[model samples]
Target: MSQSKITPKSYKVLAVDDNEDITELLEYTLSKEGYQVKTTWDGSTAIQLAQSFLPDLILLDISMPIMDGIEAGRLLRQIPALDYTFLIYLTARVEEYAEVAAFDIGADDYLIKPIKPRALVSRLKALLRDKNELAYSSTEFRIGDLKIDSLSYTINYQNKVLQLPKKEFELLYFLVQHQDTVYTREQLLSHVWGAGMHITPRTIDVHIRKIRERTGFDYIKTVKGIGYKFTTEPENT
Candidate 1:
């Protein structure tokens, strides 16, 4: 008897943008790529739908009525159930400060407006691929007093459970995986954020700062005139 062929699961993508045209384009384009796509016109409605839909990825816009994407992202981060969902901000804001703020708020990638359809699709595919790879790679990691469980996307820090955004967790995990290895800002960006992504190296600094603040440990060391390193031997220890 011949075995039946098995098909891979399609990724679920939720797009929240006020522009009908953009949403329609995303739906049509993503649908063609075999993704389960859903669209909402506002952040408030998007949040409500997200709880039920539980999408694997979210394409969010920063400006909208009712609620903006930043507020929505803040609220979503508070929900433990949605911790693993990848968020990409699609906005027209090209300011460096705005990009920094978006990254600070847990955005995995920020794509400025006037993006090419094919490029957007390629980026989405890359993000989903990376996410899937991380999910299936490993589940548990222990470094000093910091315990990281990729399966639950939670970190046990000094007996307290802390939830880090996807990018932050990935960054920490990568650094911890290669303890004492100093990675330049550019190298870290390529490794963590993926290559071809239009993000400044300073973005890495912001994420590192956040991780330091949350963990209350200066394990990530900065080498002057270079980049950063994750040292098992933390300073002031």
Candidate 2:
């Protein structure tokens, strides 16, 4: 998993390229960093891999046989279930159209083909760093009695531990890290799911319920027309 490589935690990465050499290079490069990576030449299998891997990031090639990267990306984005997968594209040097298309379809970044293995690794590390930073910039937050580690993804309450599923953990981490900030379903979907994933806005509600049930954060407030907020400090009545 991508997370495992960088943070000693489970994180997965999916790399797609019709060229065996390119796929192999990416897998080798990323794996050297202790990242768990999966790669394939088949674009049709992209969605299936996504569902199974729940990758932290996907590096997709723009051109391929059978199914193209654009189509694969569109399909992934249309699922309305995977809300947290980041996407980057590998394009030929002359493929300007593919670059534009990659961004239009929701790719966060793009790299020219015949990639420098070292450079690719560097970019991935930088991307992950920014992601972690943006997701957990807060100093501290308490949702009810639950205490969350902004950097570690560890949670505790009243000296008791609370375990969470992969997606659930990420969602709760985001909410508590940004306590007191009201976030709409779409915003949460975008940030948590990533631009590469297609997810319904209402999925937040389900995760919210799951979060409330699993932890002591019974005080998570709903804004009705908007979304939810977890306030560490109680409101003055």
Q: Pick the candidate with the highest lDDT.
A: 1
Q: Residue 201 deviation, candidate 1, in Å?
A: 1.4
Shift of residue 183 alpha carbon in model 1, Å: 1.4
Residue-level lDDT tens digits of model 2 in 182-221: 9898888677656543344545776677667777556567
Cα lDDT for residue 122, candidate 2: 71
Give the residue spans of candidate 1 off by over 4 A: 1-9
* Alpha-carbon TM-score of each model against the true structure: 0.90, 0.55
lDDT of 1 by residue, 15-105 (tens): 9999999999999888887888899988899889999999888899999999998888878777767877888999998889888988888
Native-referenced Cα lDDT, model 1: 0.85
What lDDT does the true structure give each of the candidates?
0.85, 0.70
